[model samples]
Target: MRIHILGICGTFMGGVALIARELGHHVTGSDLNIYPPMSDALAASGIPVRLGYEPKNIDPKTDLVIIGNGIARHNPCVDYVLNQGMDYISGSQWMCENVLRHQHVLAVSGTHGKTTTTALLTWILETAGLTPGYLIGGVPKDFKETSRLGAGKYFVIEADEYDTAFFDKRSKFLHYRPRTLIMNNIEYDHADIFPDIEAIKKQFQYLLRCVPSNGSVIFPNSDTNIQDVLSRGCWSTQMATGDESGWYAKLLTPDGGAWECYFKGEKRALIKWHLVGNHNVQNALAAIAAADSIGVAMHDIEKAFATFSNVKRRLEIRGCVNEVTVYDDFAHHPTAIATTIDGLRKKVGEQRIIAIAQLGSNSMRMGAHGDALSFSFQAADQVHVLRPEDKSWDVAAVLKPLGNKAFVHDSVADIIDVVSKAALKHDHVLIMSNKGFDGIHERLLDKLSV
Candidate 1:
């Protein structure tokens, strides 16, 4: 089938395009922002990408139009699809109807760690020679790609709770039927769409309902948020979170990047992971449980864990100069930021934990999480918030309570200048945002070099 993807520049959409292209479909796409590496990625695949949505781009001969959730009712192409009555469907719906039916899908869903956990789970299966097909939200460093449409009975995907499309407002994951579900912890996110934390939780419950009785859910142990949703109903579920959890994880060496995790407090898997958070320990466990359910041996999982390359931008090192290391993470939510800090603290110890965070994602930029930003940085030695370029709120008011410990600046360049001037000799500078922060990591690395 010839498939045209709307909003192909998004991370998820770009992944879909590649996967569709792999499926031997004639894939064409259009987006408002058509730039590298998405543009470069598509061009390499011999797929022509158009700029901006136009009715003409719809191509009457196209078999199916895969509209990304980012597209809405008003796009000119979308309007034309409606007016002309073209055959189209949401990306998730398309995947459900064509790709996932009758497949044993190992679905990973949560506000945080979905991409990482999905990558880890897929890695375990792939290492065991399972050759599972997968559609991860982020580019896995191990694979150098996000989506794979291969010949395998198992399909692993990062199940999202966000609305499927402007037309289908239900959570996207409901379209996915999983024989095995991993419910990582949930919280308030995408405030632009969901009104409250509970609203988001309700959607998660809906996702949980999709799992069949034969399928078991591996979830975090101590999370009250997960507890609340599970309390409402019963499902085939298991636990994997804390020190005393059902499926426990043991870290062999506490030294920074290398970790050996034990399930049930007995040595299970050993790996050197770049991710720096206890939250990631839980992420690893979720993968272990999913793999065990799928018949992958513990020995193979341990080997895959050792060789697994981390996901892109989750804690990616952009550049390092002078005496400081400049790192990047897509940690926009307050809870995510706090967990990132906790992981770094475990590694760096008393080294000045310099964090430059941006309120860039939809939720952090305009939610009731003004106070969350302050509490999120309790683990950091110094907190610096990039005064939102979005103008979502009075930046001063939202961050005023942090007082002398926190500083809010209006420009990424200004934040770089401050960090460059005052950072300690061995400080680790963390640049946190869901989107690129005007390439602040590069600027800071350059300044620190001098």
Candidate 2:
């Protein structure tokens, strides 16, 4: 089968293209923002990717058209597909029908930590010799690529709550009926699509309805929002992290690398690794419960936890120049920003945390978080907000409550200048952004090195 994918540069769509190629289909794709390393990955997989959407890129002989959520009505290729009555399905729908249908899917879904948790669970399954297939949004350092078709019956997916496509208004996770679902805490996000928290919650309720009675819904017990979502109705078995009865974790190390895991109050095994923070600890617990539910031994999970490498851009250290370390993170939400900073704070106590955050996400850029953004950065010694050149939110005014602790910059150059001058030895320069902050991490490193 020859499949043409529209908007294939996106992480999810790119992964889907790879999966299609691996599944023996000749896959070709096109996107307006066709850049590496997704483009490089597609090229390596022998899939030709056109730069932009046009009616010609649709491939007249194409067997099926997989439209990415990023594609909308104005796209010439989309218009052609609709006008010609070409068979089309969303990227998520294609995966559900072609790939996931044959496998036991384990989906990691939530507003935050989906990529990290998905990577962790996939590693756990791989370590247990399950050889699980996986589709992750970001490139996992453990597995150099984003998606693969494995020999095992298990498939691990990073389930996103975002709409599947312009035509399909439902959350992408709805199409993925996973046997094991990890709801890793939910909060209001994606201000462009969702009007309120309840609107997002309603979508979550639909996701819960898809799970079979034999399946299990894994989540952190501490989240009231998740508790509210489940209250509506949950037919599947429920597992909770941070609770004594279900599945819980006890932090041992000060850096939060070692955890004592218990299921039903019985000591399962001690998981020790290099990942930091209580959020990661919760992620580990969710993975542990999900893996154990599928019959993976606790000791095997311990081995996987010991060797699990984090996903790229999730607290990934870009470099250390002159004793000033620069870290990259995909933390755009208020909760994620707070957790990432708190995690780093645990690692480097008393060291000046120069938090360089980009309000790139729609929610953050629209000033939806308002004063909470200031509170999210209270843990950092100083917060540097790289105001998006396209969006005007008056971050300085939004962060007025923080006074001099917060500084807003109009350009990346200004941020680099300020950080280059202010960053000192032993300072942890944490750069947080969902998208590339105009390559600030490396540019900052070069400046600091000079």
Candidate 3:
């Protein structure tokens, strides 16, 4: 099959492309302003990616067009395909039909930690010799690629709640039909598509309906939002984390670098890994439960946890210059921002944390999290926010509660200049964003080296 994907640079769409290629399909794609590591991955796969969404980019011999959620109606490529009467399908639907239908899908879904949890579960399965096929939203340090066609019958995917495509408005996870589902915590996010928290929960409620009766649903006990979603209806066996009644983690270290895994009020294993944060501990507990449901032994899960390297950009250290370290993280939502900062604070102790953040996600740009943003950075000694070009919301005013501790900059250059000057030895600079942030990580490292 010859397939051409629209908005192919997106992490999900890119993963689809890779899996399609691995299946012996001739795949090509087009997107605007392409950047790595998706671009890098696509290039390595020998998949030709055309820049921009020009109508001419679509090959006449293309057998099918797989549209990404980011590509909407009236795009030149979309119109071209429609006018030409070309066959089209959304990426999620195609994934469902082509790959997921044949495998025992273990999907990790939530607003945050989906990527990490999916990667962790995949790693655990792989270590157990399952060699589970997997699709992660981001690059994992433990895996060579974001998606793969594993030899095993199990397929682990990072399930997202975002709308499928321009044509398919349903949440992407609705099509996954996971046998084992992990709902990590959920809060209001993707404000562009979702009107409110209830709207997001409705999508999750629908997702639960897709899980088979024999499957298992793992979640945290303390999350009222998840509890509310489950209250609507659920058929799968439930496994709760964060409490003694279900799978739980007894934190052995303040930073959550070490923990005792417990199931049904008994010690299962002691997990000690490089990853920190209570959020991560929760993610690990969920993964352990899901892996256990699949019959992976506790000792194997412990071994995998010890060797897990984590996904890229989740508090990954980019470089250390003159004893000043720079870390890259993919934290956009208010909850994610707070947890990430808190994790680093616990790990670094009293060392100065210079948090550089960009309001890159649609929700942040629309000021949906404006109120909560004020308290998200309390763990950091200093906060630097990159003010988006959109003036609809006042970034500085939203962060005014932090007073002198927080600084808002209008440009990447201005932020780099200010942050480089302010950073001192033993300082940990954490750059947080869902997007590339104009390659600020490398540019700031260059400035810090001077």
Candidate 4:
């Protein structure tokens, strides 16, 4: 099969390309901006990628076109496909038909932690000798590629709630009929697509409708939003984390690098890992429960957790220069930003923490989280926010609550200059964004090194 993917640089679409290539398909793709680690993975796999969405990029011999959600109507490639009467399908639908249908899919879904939890569950299955096929939204340090066709019946996926494609407005997760579902705490996000939190919940309610009666759904016990969605209807066996009634974690350390796992009031295992944040502890509990439902033993789960390296861009440390460490994190939402900062605060303990953030996600740029954005940076000593190009909201006014602690810049160059000057020994600079942030991490590091 010859396949051409549009918007192929996106993490999810890139994963789909890798899976298709692994299946012996001749796959090629094109995107506006291509960067690692997806670009690196694609190159290593010998899959060719074009620079832009030009109509000429699509090969005449291409048998199918898989469209990414990021690619909207009227893109030259999209119009070319339509005018040429070429067969087309969304990445999610193609994944469902080509791979997920044959495997027992274990899906990790939510506003945050989906990528990490999916990588964790996939590693758990791998350690148990299941060799489960998986598709993670981001690069996992432990895995060679973001997606693979394993030799086992299980397939783990980081299920996203974003719309499938311009043609199909439904959430992408609707197509992944997961047997084991992990609903990591949900919240209002993707404001460009969803009008409100209720709109997001309605999509989750539909996702619940996809889970079978024999499958299991795991979630944090304290999340009322998840509870509200479940109230609508659910046939799957329910497992709640962060409480005594279901899976729980007793944090042995404040940073969450070590913890004791519990299941229904009994000790299951002691998990000591390098990952931080209470959110990750909750993610681990959910992964444990889902793994248990599939008959993976507690000891094996403990072993897997011990060796879990975590996915890239989730509080991943990029480098340490002159005793000042720089971390890269994929935290765009206010809730996620708060949790990530809180975790690092606990880890560093009174050390000067500098946060360089970008309002990169559409929701942030549209002011969906503006009210709570200022509060999310309380833990950081200094907060520098890269002003969005949209200019729909006043980034400076939104972060005004932080007073002198916050600084808003119109360009990545300005942010890099300010942060590089402010950083000192023992300062932990956490750069938060969903996009590349114009390669600020390396540029800032270079400035600091000089």
lDDT values, one for every candidate: 0.82, 0.90, 0.94, 0.93
- On the 0 to 100 scale, the lDDT of residue 386 in model 1 is 79
TM-score: the better of candidates 3 and 4: 3
- 2 or 3, which is superior by lDDT? 3
Report the lDDT tens digits of candidate 3 across residue range 1-450: 999999999889999999999999999999996888999999999999999999999999899999999997988999999999999999999999999998999999999999999999999999999999999999999998999989989999999999999888999999998999999988999999999999999999999999999999999999999999999999999999999989988888999999898888899999989999999999999999999999999889989999999999999999999999999999999999999999999999999999999989999988999999989998899999988877898989999999999999888999999999999999999999998898999999999999
Summed over model 2, clashes come to: 0
Global Cα lDDT for candidate 1: 0.82
**Best model number under TM-score:** 3
* Candidate 3, superposed: residue stretches over 4 Å from native: none
lDDT (10s digit) by residue, model 2, range 64-169: 9999997887888989998898899999999899888878899999998899999999999999999999999998989968999889899999999999999999
Cα lDDT tens digits, model 4, 1-450, are: 999999898889999999999999999999998888889999999899999989999998899999999998989899999999999999999999999997899999999899999999999999999999999998898899999999989999999999999999999999999999999988999999999999999999999999999999999989999999999999999999999999998989999999898888899899988899998898889899999999998889888988999998999999999989999999999999999999999899999999999887989988899999999998899999988887677889988989999998878999888888888899999999998888899998898999
For model 4, which pairs clash?
Answer: none
Question: Which one wins on lDDT?
Answer: 3
Angstrom error at residue 339, model 4: 0.3
TM-scores, one per candidate: 0.94, 0.98, 0.99, 0.98
Clashes found in each candidate (C-alpha, N, C closer than 3 A): 2, 0, 0, 0
Report lDDT (Cα) of residue 425, candidate 4. Answer: 96
